[model samples]
Target: MVEPAHPKRRRAASWILAVVLAVFVTMGAVGCSPSLGSPPCMPPEYRVNPSSAKPGEAVTVSAPDATCNPRYGSNAQIRIVFTDAMGVEVLNTTAPMTDKGGFAFTTEVPTPTAVGEVAVYAAPEGVDWCDDTGTNNRAGSGEDELEMASCAKPMKPLTITK
Candidate 1:
């Protein structure tokens, strides 16, 4: 075997790399942990003001801004959907994010003048849930945030009487 000339330098470089990786793991876990909630993994949430309103009344859908964490890819353009008591889609629109995560859109509640309940829910922005792009293919080990978000999230519900 040939003797290495810079063995000391090689060891020093390895030590530095290890330290750097350790720091990264500690600092990055806060944003990437599988846990869900605010300050970390705040899942997308939505609500409508005045749970009770008249038909065709003005209403606001809020998908409040969230922590732009790197681990959980919650970057989808939040979609605001208002449906009738029968679960029929009444109003459908996409809300734009103000800063990082949360989004909001204002719309009027619709109805057929039925004296029943109305519902408002949310979902990911795009129609197709599958991502074939290299950036979001959580098919195997070592998947990115965007890929993990491909799965559907529990839709937030808001009930308002008209």
Candidate 2:
């Protein structure tokens, strides 16, 4: 006949199994912790001081509310486009993010001798959370085009007279 396990051995084996299970549970909890999720990602917030500027004037474009999704860190690029009333692009500048997780650009309205309006546009280089895709991806990534609402607005008309 087969001998049954001793009571002391059985108790020790049960304790070992319990400890192993506890360790596994603890590890799983840690692996699935909130901290393990993507960092708090934040979309760029474009703000232009004065919002309207005359020719020969300078405007400040700042990203004050800019922040990286805490889980993803700050990894993004910025591009600024300046266009004239004729729908002709005059200036295009790309500024990379600094270690501070923010960026800014200063542009001067050109004093055109022609009468027309000027517009400035700020767009995130890649996907933007504010975009319809709801994820920060690069532009043309099958994602909706990301643009700054304020920047997309047409600028005040400037009358050029001899």
Candidate 3:
């Protein structure tokens, strides 16, 4: 006659299986699983043509790889901002994201009092929802934007030459 397994052993094995299953489920949920209906989280990129420019010169800034799906959803606008070395907002404008989440616009470089470097930053504004980060906090709480929007601020370096 064969002996039956001990009650304690059976309970331990069941507990271990439960824990392992839970871990796998959590991992899949957190992982970047495209099948889970979550788009890959990619920071919107900024592109500057003629990166180095003289004051009053026309410069074009574009973001051709920005996407709003699975986070901001449709009907989101990407705002382009130009800030001087002193952190002063010199120019600001908004562009509608294309179906492919890209936009292009031209603006004259701001002629600051002194010739210095100006930074170009872009972020999605007026988003419908913002996703929680690894820390479980709202991601996009900032000035002039939705509190829950993802604050993926991609920047481009620009030099103002004399």
Clashes of 3: 0
The numbered model that scores best in lDDT is 3
Note the Cα lDDT for every prediction shown.
Answer: 0.56, 0.55, 0.66
lDDT of 1 at 42: 40
Question: Tens-digit lDDT track for model 1 on 21-101?
Answer: 997787666663444322233434667776667777777767655454423244456567666667677777776654334
How are the candidates ranked when ordered by TM-score, highest leading?
3, 1, 2
**RMSD score of candidate 1 (Å):** 9.0
Give candidate 2 regions above 4 Å deviation: 1-42, 65-76, 99-101, 113-117, 126-162
TM-score between candidate 2 and the true structure: 0.47
The 10 consecutive residues of candidate 3 with the worst lDDT sum are 129-138
Whole-model lDDT, candidate 2? 0.55
Ranking by lDDT: 3, 1, 2
The RMSD (Cα, Å) of candidate 3 is 6.5
